[model samples]
Every structure is written in structure tokens, then in C-alpha cells.
Target: MKDLIKAINGHLAAEFQASHTYLAMSIWLRKKDLAGFSSYMLAKSNEERGHASRMIAYLVDSDETVELPT
Candidate 1:
């Protein structure tokens, strides 16, 4: 269970990193006047964030410690 929790936390961290990357891309696209692409990237970022949120909820429901990544 500890190992599983560790692995899940690692994946959660990756999800957050992906979200940040997408948000940066979205901002860059908007700056370049690509409204459609920017919106798409923004949606992707939101989706990644939602995934992370779900992971967090799962850990809490399982009564496991959630060690947030740095």
C-alpha cells in the first residue's frame, strides 16, 4: 500500500506538471493571436488539474498520506 501511494503521488505530480505546461502553452498561443489553439490548450490544462484532484480525493478516501511533490 505504501508503494502504491508513492506511485500515485508521483503520477499526481506529473499531472500537475502537465497542467502547468499546458497553461504556459495556452498563454503563448493567445499571445500569438491563436484563439482556438489557446482555448484548446487551456482545456487540456484544466483536464490535467481535474485528474490530479481526483487522485488527491482517492488518497484521502483511502486514508493514506498524500505527500505533495515539491
Candidate 2:
């Protein structure tokens, strides 16, 4: 269970990083006046955030220690 939690936390970190990267890309696109691309990237970033949330919720519900990644 501890190992599982650790793996899940690692995955969550990856998802968070992905979200951050997507957001940065979206902002850059918007600055370049590419509204469509920017919107798409923004949506992807939101989806990644949702994925991270679900992982955290699962950990909490499973009675596991939720150690947030740095």
C-alpha cells in the first residue's frame, strides 16, 4: 500500500508538471494571437489538473497518507 501510494504520488507530480507545461504553452500561443491553439492547450491543462485531483481523492479515500510531491 505504501508503494502504491508512492507511485500514485509520482504520477500526480507528472500530471501537475504536464498541466504547468500546457498552461505555459497556452499563454505563449495566446500572446501570439493564436486563439484556437491557446484554447485547446488551456483545456488540456484543465484536464491534467482534474486527473491530479482524482488521484488525490483516491488516495484520501483509500486511507493512505497523501504526501504531496515537491
Winning model by lDDT:
1
Clashing pairs in 1: none
Could you list the CA RMSD of all candidates, in the order they appear? 0.7, 0.9
Candidate 1 residue 64 Cα shift, in angstroms, is: 1.0
Candidate 1 segments whose C-alpha is farther than 4 A from its true place:
none
lDDT of 2: 0.93
Q: Write candidate 1's Cα lDDT for 1-70 as tens digits.
A: 8889999999998999999999999999999999999999999999999999999999999999887877
Model-by-model lDDT, in order? 0.95, 0.93
* lDDT accuracy of residue 31 in candidate 2: 100
Give the clashing residue pairs of candidate 2, or none: none
